[model samples]
Target: MASAPVIISAHLSIPDAELVERFVRASGAGGQNVNKVSTAVELRFDVAGSPSLPEPLRSRLLARRDRRMTGEGVLVIDAQRFRTQDRNRDDARERLAAFIQESLSVPKPRVATKPSYGAKLRRLDEKKGRAQIKRGRTTRNWE
Candidate 1:
């Protein structure tokens, strides 16, 4: 079990085995560098099979509507903004760590409640004011 390349947080970390990085030629303007060098990095993480993630967290991550996420529960991050392989690799790893750390946190469930009497009254008053404004517009002065 090799140490992970990126550390998500103090307590949680994804193993290096679960992460796969592939370098490819970056698209766009970069003189001869773009044509010859493979600076872009494609970092892939298997969210479903990673033992580091809890079951609930895995499910939540997979459930997210991210186009980068594959149907097979793999999250693919493309880092090509940088001109160097090291920078791109670092960027990819940082993004993956941020994403996983974000996924680890559970959102508080919303508590349902009826509108207050004052709020209802305020809403009705606003509606009445708008109705008055429309009535005034209809009886406008055509000079």
Candidate 2:
């Protein structure tokens, strides 16, 4: 809704409708307030069910082993640090944005490299030194 959800990275995108979840008071702590108000934000993002997300991205998201992600591919982000519901809600949104941004980042391609001549020589030298040390420990025979 707000400028197509600020694209934090290349592959991440937050849709307007998906960000509508609200904050409620989390269970435990603030004995009275816990029972009275729902201040903890419980962000529920259906990664598997979201129609807007691309298939590859959806699969990648579901494959992640995040504690918040349920077996059914629903991500439940909880933000209860802040006392007010609005702050907690904002925090949850921020975290969700971060997750999406990280997920979208492209990893560097690995390049295969062979051992350098100098490195190989050093390794051989070390092996020779070990062999020489072992030889020195053997009993010497004098005729």
Candidate 3:
């Protein structure tokens, strides 16, 4: 309950109770701050067990191929791109919101189509031209 709820979309918001954030020492590019302070934020959300998410969204999030997903279905996001604790913390929450939002959108199914007759003929013509060029490169006795 440290901050406002994570807004995934206009209709969906995940409360702070559903999210867990831990501060850790960042690896690089923060000067002495990297060595002393725990600026990196590790945010965790249970995609499978959370009551906040709808079933379809939860399933879609779980089905995602991201390596961040744990075997227990927790989505862990690590944010250390900033040098400050507040910045990194916000980044982690923002990333989580964006991820959840991404799962909400369902892509339209792709409709397969055959190449046009003209396109097929053009491809064949290009292949013939290349073959003709290759044929000209052969060494002939010419005797």
Best by lDDT: 3
lDDT of 1: 0.90
Q: Kindly list the per-residue Cα lDDT of model 2 for residues 1-143, writing each as its tens digit.
A: 24246344565566767655765658767878878898988878888898767787777788888998998888888899877887887788788878866666456789999999999999999999999999999988876
Candidates 2 and 3 compared by TM-score, better number? 3
Cα RMSD, model 1: 2.4
The TM-scores of all predictions, comma-separated, are 0.91, 0.67, 0.88
Model 3: residue 86 alpha-carbon error in angstroms: 1.4
Candidate that beats the other on lDDT, 2 or 3, i.e. the better one: 3
Please report the TM-score between candidate 3 and the true structure: 0.88
Summarize candidate 3's per-residue lDDT along 1-143 as a digit string, tens digits: 37999888888999998898999999978678789999999999998999999999898998889999998999999999998889998999999998888889887899999999999999999999999999999989978
lDDT string for model 1 (5-26, tens) is: 5788787788787799899999
In order, the Cα lDDT scores of the candidates are 0.90, 0.77, 0.92
Which pairs in model 1 have colliding backbones? none
Query: lDDT score, residue 29, model 1?
Result: 97
